[model samples]
Target: MKEKYLSTRRTYRESVRPHDGEVRFQVAVEQTDLLIVAQEDLRHEIASFVFQVRGEIKNWILFHPEFAESLSPVIVDDGAPEIIRAMAQAAALCDVGPMAAVAGAVAQAVGDFFSPRTPNILVENGGDTYLHSTRERVVALLAEPDSGAVVGLGIEAEAFPVAVCASSATIGHSLSLGAGDLVAVRAQDARLADAAATALCNMLRSEADIASVLERAQILAEFGVEGVFAQYNKKIAAWGNVELVALN
Candidate 1:
């Protein structure tokens, strides 16, 4: 299995922090490195939740090794834990493996765990995020290396508790069959966003594939997908309510 590394760029988070009065912190454990933003510094609560969720996932994977290693969706029993079930659902939706949704699933679980206590919460696992904010938030896109582009999406405040997940073929250790530099998806939940991003990236083999990918992505809008953004060879394409903006 490929080891997961920290894929999220902190510069974007730092640039947008002033708009929201949320405190930011980091929690690292094994393969998981989470960048969390909340109303207050809740390191203890964050640590407890991360460990418990990670443990449950690790234990389930141990019992069902196929779930962790499969590149295709596997049937999960109803008796599985909520997180496990969520992973299965996301994988099935995108026709990918359950592990593809791991980061987003974990982020969503943590966000849900603290939603009642915090009015605004943002949890980023790798490049996948679970965001719930009272005000609009702009999440920057860190797509190519050494590129002079400052692209991002201006998510409306009404779109709170949405997931913005990214997948890349030129970056990170995740498995992808496409050549897209970055593919981001917005959904009602992080798990679906993460899985869909991976599935979309896998279809984008070249610049010519952008249109078809966008069409497929638009079909997901009915499934709570707010938008889709993809960049390849300096060419960018987007569909749905994606508020693209350039930062100074």
Candidate 2:
């Protein structure tokens, strides 16, 4: 039988004691409570990969617009492909264009995680996540509507590990397009998740913009997007391959 373990996914005002032997990394420092979970080794590695990938993205993408546009098609190309693909996806959102920042880097982050060993590695840099390996990973996503609480996403996996990422205007330091507190995206690769989350947030500039954004998201969804979580003007929506989790 397949093995599964569920730890105390915490949503207090402070970080929890991480599962034994897991490396700790700080993405951002804030004065408020943080949502944290103690997962298996595979999930931790994936998360680390996302952190590293996003760190690289912050180094490469945020300020570079032309180069990001240049990467649109080649994102699917291997060798750090995920983030590039994500950048291409993000480019669809703005008049200024994607320009290789948050979303694009997120994709690259997930891809970076998969680049190494084949363990069930999954990484979530803020909201952008990438998953690999054969084990099924169920991730709980935290959103704004739940009043800074945990929302459960009881996702069962197939033969491959999955990646998940989210963005928020009210939380974390990353940029967001919609005003909602949280937006998320899931894909086989972190780059896509990163790009999609950014795109979805962009779509939500206003409720008036929702249709166009969804249209654009769908137009790009054919690019093999698995799921989307978006909020604008105080609303949240989660699309395919996604579920919300609640942890008190």
Q: Estimate each model's TM-score.
A: 0.92, 0.59
Candidate 2 per-residue lDDT over residues 79-126, each given as its tens digit: 444455455545554222444245435434444444454344444444
Q: Which candidate number would show the highest lDDT if scored against the true structure?
A: 1
Q: In model 1, which regions exceed 4 Å deviation?
A: 1-20, 147-149
How far does residue 16 in candidate 2 sit from its true spot (Å)? 8.3
- 53-135: candidate 1 lDDT, tens digit per residue: 99999999999999999989999999999999999998887889999999999999999889899878888887788888888
Model 1, TM vs. native: 0.92
> How many steric overlaps are in each model, in order?
0, 27
Give residue 107's error in model 2 in angstroms. Answer: 6.9
Query: What global local distance difference test value does model 2 have?
Result: 0.50
For each candidate, what is the lDDT?
0.84, 0.50
- Which pairs, if any, clash in model 1? none
Worst 10 residues of 2 by lDDT: 1-10
